[model samples]
Target: MSQAPVVGVAVFVVKGDKVLLGRRRSSVGHNTYALPGGHLEFGESFEECAAREVKEETGLDIKDIQFITVTNNVFTEAAKQLHVVAVIMRASLVDPEQLPQNVEPEKCDGWDWYDWKNLPQPLFQPLETMLKNGFSPFPAKLN
Candidate 1:
């Protein structure tokens, strides 16, 4: 039997002109850069999921969470197919002075802020999809 597609929440925490990203360490997207987020929990709103995932993975508090866009991602690894519906969100860090740390060493290495125009290479599949679709979290550019 096949499993249903999982819904994931990808949060872009903006601080000044940069967005926070984590270098993944897990098998799913190992060695790829991705936003701080994870699978959505039952009965949880997108904002709640974003905040929770950010804090849990990056140790940062985020607020003003808002919907950005969604990407339908279907990919395969090790001959195993996987499908994920990625719900993208954008927000600002609640405390600008607080730096991001690697809270989940098993899944992520550490977090860093990067400019949108010059993002790091080898981004996670879903994030790459969003960029290809011209999805920008910045208010000045939506496409």
Candidate 2:
């Protein structure tokens, strides 16, 4: 039997014209500012995964979660193979001032909010696309 695909979740938290981003921990795409997210555990719902990943990676609690897109990522590195089905979501901050708890210190070097119009190109391609498209890729579905 083919194994169930690994599902991942990402959050694009926006306020005004700026969006929240996190720098990756390792060298896979090190020093790059990407959306805050991670893979889901077994039996966890997509919304729960989005909330958990955002908090773990950025120390931010997000609510009013909504789905965006479901895409498959096939990774080919050396002899290892990884298939990731990513679910993107939109959410509002519970409280920005609240210090993120249990953050993986080594995973992310920094976090910043960037203006959607002037995002740094070299480190943020996917984000650039998402913002440029007016966030149309994410449809709002409150559940």
Candidate 3:
């Protein structure tokens, strides 16, 4: 029997025309760009997980966290099958002036702002699922 798919929360922080992203260095999506998120901790809501993950990985507090979409992602890499249930959310920085930094240098290369239309290549699977399903994080004002 295989293990159950892990549940993860992906927080999309939009500022103007760009969204916050980080290049992953860990196994699941190593060398691929992804939103700042991780496994859902026990007793934490999806919004709570999004906020906590953003703060933990990006060194910024996120506000207005709202549910966006969910994706069931299944993929195989190097003959190892993996699956994940991804909870996607949108948020903004509590302080606009606060910049994001790499809080987990061992797991991530760094954080950067990328235009939605020009996202970096080799995106993490969950994120690619969102994009393929027409998920957009840009605020109405910017869209």
Candidate 4:
């Protein structure tokens, strides 16, 4: 049997009308636009991993990770079997004034704030689906 692919976490962090985005560096899909988060290191909780990834990639501290959707991605076109379990989280910014420097500049080409209603195509695809149709696997309690 083929090995199971790696699991990762993604956060759709929002502030006002903008969402945080990370321009992919040299990973699975280099130079692609993606959420500002990544995989969970061994021995780390999903929430902790989410926070650490956001801080490391986008120079932002995130807190209070709420449950979102999960994506099971299988890359069959790469000639190599790679599966990814992405746990999408809804988190908030801990501080807006103190954006840190990108720890891995090579992995993140740039960061930008785009309007939610009209996001660039680079930030489209699955993210657009997430925005339009949120998680429905479980009941969500409204405030």
Candidate 5:
């Protein structure tokens, strides 16, 4: 089989002043902090993929989904080189009081909410690039 880039949907599930992130236990970004997202399913909209991945990975529901940005990531450190086109999206939690649960412990250590200005170390490739470019998923406050 030939290597081909895959489209991955990443969600910025925000609550109050924080956004949800998890420490990945998967090979793509092992031990690196990342958003709750996964590969985009066939025929699914970006919003749909975001919602689904959030629920699957974090056991949380999100609403007000909207596209934010995209990034092209190529990882060569792994035994198998990987390339992914990350579709970034932002969404608010459906239940503001609900806490994230690590639904897929095999793939993620656990989920935590962190302020945008102070994220944890060793971010996933896409997220690292996004932050390096000064991209904040939080929407601008309207007066």
Candidate 6:
């Protein structure tokens, strides 16, 4: 059997120099810090996927969902391999005072904003791929 790359939507919810991340509890990258997102559903726009997944996982409403970049990531497990075309995005909270909660504790530990330049250790693979390529949502224009 053959498999195709699935679309994985990830959102960077930016506030000042900080972005939100959660410690994943899922199998794909268990225990690694990752952004709020999930697989895109059929017929759903990238923006819609971004908004829905963030809200579903973190209980956070976001706006200004903008296309950031895409990374082709391939993961391998014993006798299995998965490929994903990760559609990365950037957004802001609908309300600046809105706090993130662990809406889906089964999937993630919790969500909290962290400095982009000083991210948490053991980042999820796809995110690590992005950083290795010099991707920074926050340019000097942000500060």
TM-score quality measure for candidate 2: 0.75
Q: Which parts of model 6 are misplaced by more than 4 Å? A: 78-80, 139-143
Q: How displaced is residue 41 in candidate 5, in Å?
A: 1.0
- Model 3 scores a C-alpha lDDT of 0.88
- Model 1 clashes, total count: 0
Q: TM-scores, in order shown?
A: 0.92, 0.75, 0.91, 0.79, 0.95, 0.93
TM-score of 3: 0.91
RMSD of each: 2.1, 4.5, 2.0, 3.5, 1.3, 1.8
Which candidate ranks first by TM-score, i.e. highest?
Answer: 5
15-37 per-residue lDDT for model 4 (tens digits)? 76677776776546556677877
Error of 1 at 60 (Å): 0.5
lDDT of 5 by residue, 1-143 (tens): 76999999999998878989999998878999999998999899999999999999988999999998989988889989988999999999899988899999999999999998889999987899888888888778899
For model 2, name the residue pairs that clash.
25-107
Candidate 1 displacement at residue 111 in angstroms: 0.5
Question: Is 3 or 5 the stronger prediction by TM-score?
Answer: 5
- Per-residue CA lDDT of candidate 2, range 1-143, in tens? 44456777877786656677767666455667777888888899889988888877777888888886665666554244566677888887888665444377687866777776676545544454555556643345689
From the highest TM-score down, the ranking of the candidates is: 5, 6, 1, 3, 4, 2
lDDT of each: 0.88, 0.70, 0.88, 0.71, 0.91, 0.91
lDDT of 1 at 81: 71
- Per-residue lDDT of candidate 6, residues 1-143 (tens digit): 86898899999999999999999997788899999999999999999999999999988999999998888988885256789899999999999999999999999998999998899989999898788888898645654
